[model samples]
Target: MGSRICVFLRRAGWTMWLAVLMLGPAQFANAASPDPSLVAKINAATFEVVIPRADNDPLSYEKPLPLDLLPYQERTDKYFSVGTAFAIGHNHYVTAGHVLLAAVGDLTGAPALRDANGHVYAIDKVEKFSLQQDFVMFSLKEQPQGNAALATDTKAALNSVVYAVGNALGTGVVIRDGLYTSDTPEDENGRWKWMRFSAAASPGNSGGPLLDQNGKVIGVVLMKSPNENLNYALPIGVVLGAPDNMAVMDKRITYQLDVMEDTQTSTFKAQFPLPVSYADFSAAYMKLLYAQGDEQLKKLLQQQGNDLFPHGAGSNHILHDTPELSLFPELIVRNRSGQWSYTGRELNRVPLSGNGYVASGYVGHNFLIHLRRPDDMKVATFYNDPKQMMDLILKTGYWTREVGPEKIKITSLGNPASSTTYTDNWLRHWKVFVWSLPYINGQMEVFALPVPDGLAIMMRMNSSMGTHDSLADMKALTDFFNVDYGGTLAQWKEFLADSSLLPEVLRDAHIGFDYGKHFSYDAGNISFDYPSTLQPIAPDNMLFMGVGYYQDHGKFALQPGVIQVRLNSTDPDRISAKRHIAPSPDLDDNFKEAWGKLLHKQHPYDGVPYNDGDEMDVASVIDPPASDAPAELYTAFYGTQGTHKPEAMKAKLKLLTQQFKLKTH
Candidate 1:
């Protein structure tokens, strides 16, 4: 008989071996609770398998290394190996495809397994795996005498408590309990559906058995939540239903880049090959305009035509006929005081269609352009012209769609004042000269075009992997990303010790900017936390979540769903909670207190002032806010209060200046 059968016999308990045959219905009724003897028997049957490296001896090359190294033989041992397996029938066992991933090496290579007693057995045959589920089964070369094998069953109660027995963190067998939470339906990826539970798991727990009350396996422990106690398991039914061939597992392991094509006009996304900075963007626009040969036109307008010149063939005749001409002059002109301007001049004799005209405007040190159409003077392009030279500005200024804190409005120019006889002649020829002034330095045109799906992924990558100039801040970003991705806690500590990924540009920008300074959590989605920044922008789909660098911070370039959670809680009033891991005590305290006060109502606290360091247990009392509330309410409550207010408004100005320290000067 196989060892698996022997293990089953031990679990059945010699005294009750006959009872299992007699009490079939009774056993089924109490399937939610496992027999203590069976639980222990299952635990004992689980073994920690360690494979050792071959020594560098001449004889070693001629022969294969032994299957198992003795505990006393330290020299031959290499890296620690730990995985869990359970008896299926006699000596046969089942495990995850990933567990045997490294062991199997190339196809057709035999894997050797060792029993707890140090006995070695060759893998006789292996069955294929459930590609979607990542599971596999193999039989041992020899079967143990006198043991029965446990069969898998798909019937499991929803919310029923289940136990997972596995080798956790390379330690011996341990069991954890949780309710069967959910089964995700087959998605575009494949037919596999994950079985979710609340059981806590660690690194070495993969491939272990998630068991029902009767000690029957329900699923294989696969992965666990990095931030919480949730765990995921692969359903055992997938393994039971899999075909004989295992080649499918090979294809499933390979990563495939799938670009999803979006058909919605309102939901298009585009990706650029490289990241463009504000300076680069500005330079590109300037270059595009310069290439258009507007410099010569600009010089001609600067001449300022004189009326003393005589008409053709008459020395005494004053030059009264100003040619009706509209000149598009693109030049960077600075007055004596170092102010730049954009000049568009039309010289015309008639009011509507003039003889000589000049339209001139200034764009400060930076260039600006005013595009006009005859029908509607109200709709025109103003500010720095992005299309004139480099196409730096993504879209027409008039095409702005303001949302959130962005403010966009069009103001008409006052009627032109009548010019004196001498100046009138200069202006008559300038019939439809339009000019737009640059309003703000930080402003940039947002195109109506869609943000590409790939852009979000790229942004995530930048936020997680990009190098920052500040060593301390770079380490923090790296630590956050690594830990946020399920990397070991030790890996987070190691990231702090290494600063090779820090970039030079970021370091230079940090010198005078107090790179280490950080902001409050509720101060919008953008935060300045030293060597790194966090920009959490709600994407086009208000419900869709993403991160971006809207200001001076870096961008996120990782994919969504890479680390997604439902974020569900029983407390109805605690709709959402954002936690920031800060470095200093004072900063952490301030944020915690502020956030706490904002979320919950404070009591008198025995008239001891809210600042007294007394702890209050608010977790149970504060319920989550209703989900139907407007998202903007939360965003506004979190971001800077006066962002939407115009800078010139006195009340808003005072509020921003006094409360947020905004400087208009």
Candidate 2:
């Protein structure tokens, strides 16, 4: 009896273990079945929007228009084409902010929102709006009856399956189910955090409710991924927690409006500002030079070669050998308003020329400073700061010039006492200079041949004009100018001063350069990894579907279609529908089976026309009369190639044509 009892107990234990292994572990009781009726009821609460075109009145005008005005110049009515909304309260509807923004314009031009039953409703007022989150709440003039409103729930269990019922892709009412995903922080536009999910939401689905298994509203379907099955929603808890008072709503609205207006205004200003006159530009240029560092100063000088010498030698002579000398200085007399009235002195000295030509020019007089190199056409200097360098270059009448292939020369005027002229093509390159002079209305200028290719050099010359009657008289006046030989100086200067300036000039000057090693191109193309199935969409037109899944809210995603097409087409007037055909859920299994069959098949061209070595024969068999092939067969072949070794197949085709002369024959 004891042995029998023990046997019975062991047998029961083994049975229990087998049952546990078969059934797996127990789960929570929250796995309630989804109610299809609830989805239908929720969908019934949603409405399709239709916008009517505005009438054109050619004779009507607020103000008398000119008879010569163009047709496009006349103000025409604007209207919204399509949008979506859902009932939230007795007389309130919720939709995306962008949907209602266009409807809030001038009443005469604004469009009326039409419901599914052709009932036209006026937007009484927008109760709340969040631009960042793309949400809008508006009250209707009258509410429709017989619609079942969903009850909002603040807390939803994580990973719970949820259903999104809305007019996806303008296909009327549809349902998509997926589990709750995660949430992202509020965006920069004061939008609340976004709740992420796997349920798909497409065009015309915004403002629809995401329902739980119990038929409660868990979130508002807002966005979705364009390339994937990811979706996002606005949590119902956040919507319920939002401020409901009029004062609070008004403050929020005003703040957002201000922020948007400020941003738009700033962008406009940056893109298109008031133009500056030539005279005003000169003054600003001077101020900029004064504010720059040594490196920037040198660069500024190097950029504005010939604009500093209006009456001096032409650019060809002024810039002849001095590739580095951007501008030459001239003295001029000016009135109280800073207008030049007379010439004081002009300093004409080409670098390494060994000749000093001076003309009487006054203070404040504008002159041209010229710079030219064989490789680069010409450039001129138009303005200078601190004005000291201009004074020295003008007074000294000694400029540096380049002589041989790669040599700099220094030339000096014949001394009256010594009656000797000296020219040194191999003068020791002086990277520094210091000079002091007695006060006078005279100016000095400096010039040099292409200063070590890209290296820019800054110079300063000061004078203690003995004593003057007033500060104005003693003030050191200088101007830099560039001389263009054939109107090429301006273009060169503009190119050098462009905002996208090269970085090579700004690099440390201590590093020596090998002139022989200079090359034409410096940067390479930008490359990155991207999924083969994904493609960029045009943002201006067509309709966006499933754009809320990814963190990128404004961008559209990949589309599932026979031939891939961008979510948004380039045309602004065209509306596109999301293609319904997609791979079956058992796509992976189907692919494996199909691929195995293809791998086992023998080549049909093995004994075709010509020898086996002739690739044309293989191509002929594979491409066998497209007209005779069924559409499905073509699709299968193309699709299979696209799925496996696409690049390799392309290369093989190219090789057959290029190397085997298949196409040429």
Candidate 3:
């Protein structure tokens, strides 16, 4: 299972793992009914917390269903019931902190209270909040008159009968009875004990009141243990003892980066005066939380120091190795041996309409997605239509959400709420899309790389990931991602022409061609051209552009360092070329020495054309006019049926580099 991430990129969420369910209604466990008079008093004090549904929200599913399948109020309701809250005093109301958080970043609406007779009350101020204890204290703008507050019992005896009361599943006040079980320690240092009872609490029971047999409030219902029917709640005593008019957060977080196995645990603590409106509280909390994320990320990187990616012993081999030729979207993770390598092929693949397919699997906190176009789909349409692409992906690999036993397949995501292409430090361009998921109170972030086959995507969502700076985190991880770019001649044409979809650098490194005639590839500092005579062009002929990071450059350089044009998709007969940059000190000893030999022209194969038997011809030049010391050699080779001599290979090299119009960066 992935981190339940319906998080952010530029926004927030360092999503975590917990059994606690979200805003969905909780189950109510019935052990015994509470006193009838007490029930009436409690009902008047307690109100259902609801976040109004957006009027503009529309869900497009795979097919239409019978009108009766969904309740009329559910489909046409103005508000969505999340949890419950009740009066603690004349105007003071209390609910689980997580309940208010649903409003923190929500655009649909802030939380409000709904009475038994269908009246609504707006939340006025957040008097207090605590993340760890999962509680929030606030007041209503227009408090209901004559609703008596529920009395609190700070020292209720363990093993006594208690009533779990709330607007069970939004059907109005319902009280269920269960024995007050033994206390359970809080997760972080056991700072406090939670009241655990064998109450059959369901989803909607969260934030409700857990009362004693006398109907005195003892604790606030939070979550049910996923393993058993027992439930957990914050002892009412803790809430009463907490200082007034303050917001405090003390939660333990395990920092997890996607590229490595290392983790660091730290407690996030912050405090500030409250009694602020929902808007002010949300803004303040987001600022502090995002800042905390940045600090923690920086601290973790600092703690690892040179042992992190592109620095430690693990990255040495990958830094020196040529671009990984495989185009599947996969993470570059540091293996147990302390060597960085691409995640393997144990991914889940699902077929799409056209022969196209999507593959996905976990990589640390994130997941990698590769969407390949079906052979029958037009390259241009598939490459440009991101909405269609994502729709296909969601329908297949991810699965549809269930609406009443009917699995509703998402038909489309419409347009991205925001779209921008970010070029990472290594110069890899990622098309970023943030789809507003207002219905869920978050956004679906996507960072997609345009590859030859299709899009290589990253980002977050798995509602459980629970908020963090998802955008910034994914962008940060982009540098460690390793992939190649390859496509057929037809794919190249469509991909290159769509300037709206092109990355900054790719626009300059134009892949100019004419179906079966002249073809050329240009990089910022190098250019190569070869006529169709070398390898006749067909729509299916593959062009594999190897991209690698040259860290020796002041800023890392990720470009098409090597090029191979093969005959059709399967034929080995091909033409290849590379303009190499000499390695820095980190490379293996043998590699450095071998390149040194080539630079000095000591070996026959060094800058010398040769036929290495397999009917393959090769030649290399240590440094052409535009290249310098660190920029070592340029080579071009071809493999054909007929035996070729040194002269033939040199001719091809000259043609490839004939147009040396490279502007060295």
Q: Rate the local accuracy (lDDT) of all candidates.
A: 0.32, 0.34, 0.71
State the displacement of the C-alpha of residue 494, model 1, in Å, after optimal TM-score superposition: 45
Model 1 misses residue 297 by how many Å? Answer: 52
Identify the leading candidate in terms of TM-score.
Answer: 3
lDDT winner between candidates 1 and 2: 2
lDDT of 3 at 206: 77
Indicate the worst ten consecutive residues by lDDT in candidate 1.
Answer: 16-25
Local error of candidate 1 at residue 640 (angstroms): 60
* lDDT of each residue in 1-665, candidate 1, tens digit only: 00010001111001101000000001111223367767545643454333333222211111233334334333333322435566666655777665554333211122344444444455555544443455657666666333345556687777888887665544445576778888774434555777878765666567777888778788877767666676777888777776653334212111111111111111111111212322332233234323322332223223321211111122111111111111222222223332222222322111111111112232212122222211111111211122321121112222221222332322221221111111111111111111121111011111110111100000110110011111122111121111011111122122223333112211221111222232121123222121112112211111112221111233222211111111121111111112221112323355456444434434321111122232211111112245432111111111221223222222322321122211111
Best to worst by lDDT, what's the order? Answer: 3, 2, 1
RMSD value for candidate 1? 32.1
- Per-prediction count of colliding residue pairs? 77, 81, 32
Query: Candidate 1 versus the native: TM-score?
Result: 0.31
On lDDT, the leading prediction is: 3
lDDT by residue (tens digit), candidate 3, 1-665 = 01111112221222322222223222223436676676667777888788777667444667764436767767766787766788878888888887777566765877798876668899899998998888999888897867679999999998999887765544545677788888878765888888888765765567888989898889988877767767888898899889898999889777767777787677788988988998888888888777778787878878987776667667766666566677776677787778887774437888887557788766766767878877787766676676777777776725444455565566676777777788876665778887765555556788888876788888676331234578777877887776677888777777776666565457677677766897787776677677876567678778888776565456455666778888877677777776555666767788788677667755544545555565565555535565356455655656665566767666766666565444564
